[model samples]
Target chain A: MRILEYIALMAVPAVVLFAGVVMLFGGKNYFESFIKGAKEGFATAVGLLPTLVALLAAISMLRASGAIEFISSVLKEPLSALGIPSEIIPLLLTRPFSGSASSALFSDLIGNIGPDSFASLCAAVIMGSSDTVVYIISIYFSSVNIKKTRYAFPLAFVVMLFCIFFSCFICRIWFK
Target chain B: MLGKIFGIICIVSVFFGIACGNTGQLGSAVIDGASSAVTLTLALLGMMCLWSGILNVLKEAGAIKKLTVLMTPILKFFFPDAYKSGVGSEEIAANVAANLLGVGNAATPLALSAMKKLQLQNPTPEIASRDMITLAVLNTSSVSLIPSTVITLLRSSGSENPFDIIIPIWITSFTCAAMALILCRALGSATRVRTIRSKDYKSLKTQARQ
Candidate 1:
């Protein structure tokens, strides 16, 4: 476990070091290439601002209007019956759409139920395994200007549910 | 697609807000949400730019090319059409490699570039091609070698062993990625088969008329 943590900590710096060494020996101005890419990244982020605002606004509206909470409460009984811990239900509900919101729910869950509990493990696994489906779909498709996403949204949603379930199932078995 | 979903969300939320009599909260959420989005973007800008810069250097140094070559066989399985045309395979490979390292900020720009390249090869400009959908699904069910952020959060929350969940995360992520690939391949072929059957039906009708 300690070794795994060490490797995880080193991965980023190792990649940067490798890039630096290669750039140095390759006889090109690394700063120039970096600045060029950084400029593109800045432009990309700026371009995505409107999309983020639109998506986040709708999500926040859902939260503020008590829609997500209502849905979560309704599902609590059924999901808990299926062996899912109630503590992680809110996290699962928000995770497919919003990263930050889910993170907040996750920490709150750990705080409420203790960090070493089964539900917290499940939340951690879910966090590590899945990406924000709606956010990724909207950003990626809009970036390419594709209006007709065909089956992507439905398919991604289905996959997100599967991942959530799988996360809970694995954590249940492995943590025990 | 996003339009319909966004519309539904807005309408449903507004109605719910009215029913719950939290119009004031909803109004505040409207403003707060927009500001939060801007704040989040600004917060991410530095990290995104830094990784993009590093990736640029890697690309120029030919390191990305090596990763592309190594990734081609596996990527080819998931993206046969793109591989056959040789359109956006390199960018796709780079994107997947960055994602495997759990460097999402670096992966996003590569993914956007790959999408552009794939768009050029798309027969229908407004519709997502099979390769494009596959790429998006791949991103959603991303396979990561190390999920550092999750571990950090767990550690900060005072877990006895924050890394204990690593293996479970690995298993879950790999299973999701495999399932995503299978689903996309199945869905892609199902649509293609339907189109072909319809085409055949039209051809038969034309033959009979002639």
Candidate 2:
């Protein structure tokens, strides 16, 4: 299983390289297109800067103030019973509604706690696996003028529940 | 909603930091976080530039169109009405392929067009048809082949091998997507029966249109 993960790790770069090679051989004006796309990517990255900074500052202050530890201890009993590390409680609570905010929390965790730590690893998986249900629904539905979502929110919420539980369960075993 | 949480968290943390007599460290942590965010942004800029550039090359090579063609069978199975609606299937396929590559910024417009096309074919224009709902659900839970954002974060944070989480992330995301579809299909039968038995959904849809 670990070996498979190792291959998966390597495959990301391998696949990207292969894609580039294929395109280079099979396409036209490749350099111009690449430069254009690179510029757009850089611009988008620049746009994410402020939101990331503000949210991470708040999260870091909270962590240093021992607010997270305090809250974790308060919920420690119940969370441990479910095999959830208390450190990730913040992530679970915040992730469903707002994506960037949760990601801010995630980066904070990886920075404060080493990335290989159990809590950090689990946070990474949970953040990666889950969707920002409320955010996406609000944006997509409103764009299309979908006022009555009927079962959309409820069903998506159910999937989120599964995501939280299963991601915790799997991370515990995968990285344990 | 996020603003409220942010305000609440900051106020609570700073107040507690003062009480804990760690105000100085808390201030420093905030600064560190800011610096860290800059570092992360720089790293992300590099990765996104490379991937988006490669994606541009692939797009130019018509690989994405080929991918759309490859996606037709599954797209058809999920939303046959799209194929029937002339251009709807194409838009849906483009949206899904972009999503698979984790280019969500590129997928939204494609989705809006697909949704519009699907809407055009709706017998009852006010209510969302099953195909529209499926397309929306699939788009939201879209299975990403490479989670570039998460990877960039991990790499910036100094993980020995940032991409080790790839397999796990892939499995979990794909499972969620599969579960989403299964739930949609199962409820579809239930929804059909409910539509005839109750006017609540119909009224709701009419209200939305109004």
Q: Which candidate has the top score in TM-score?
A: 2
Interface RMSDs of the predictions, in order, are: 5.9, 2.2
Model 1 clash pairs are none
- The CAPRI classification for model 2 reads as medium
- Tens-place lDDT per residue, model 1, A22-46, is 6777787887998988787778667
Off by over 4 Å in 2: B18-26, B83-87, B123-127, B196-210
TM-scores for all candidates: the values are: 0.68, 0.89
What's the lDDT for all of these models?
0.78, 0.78
Error (Å) of candidate 2 at residue A4 is 2.7
Calculate DockQ per candidate and list them.
0.47, 0.61
What is candidate 2's lDDT per residue for B77-106, written digit by digit as tens? Answer: 667566766658898899889888777677
Candidate 1 off by > 4 Å: A1-74, B1-64, B193-210
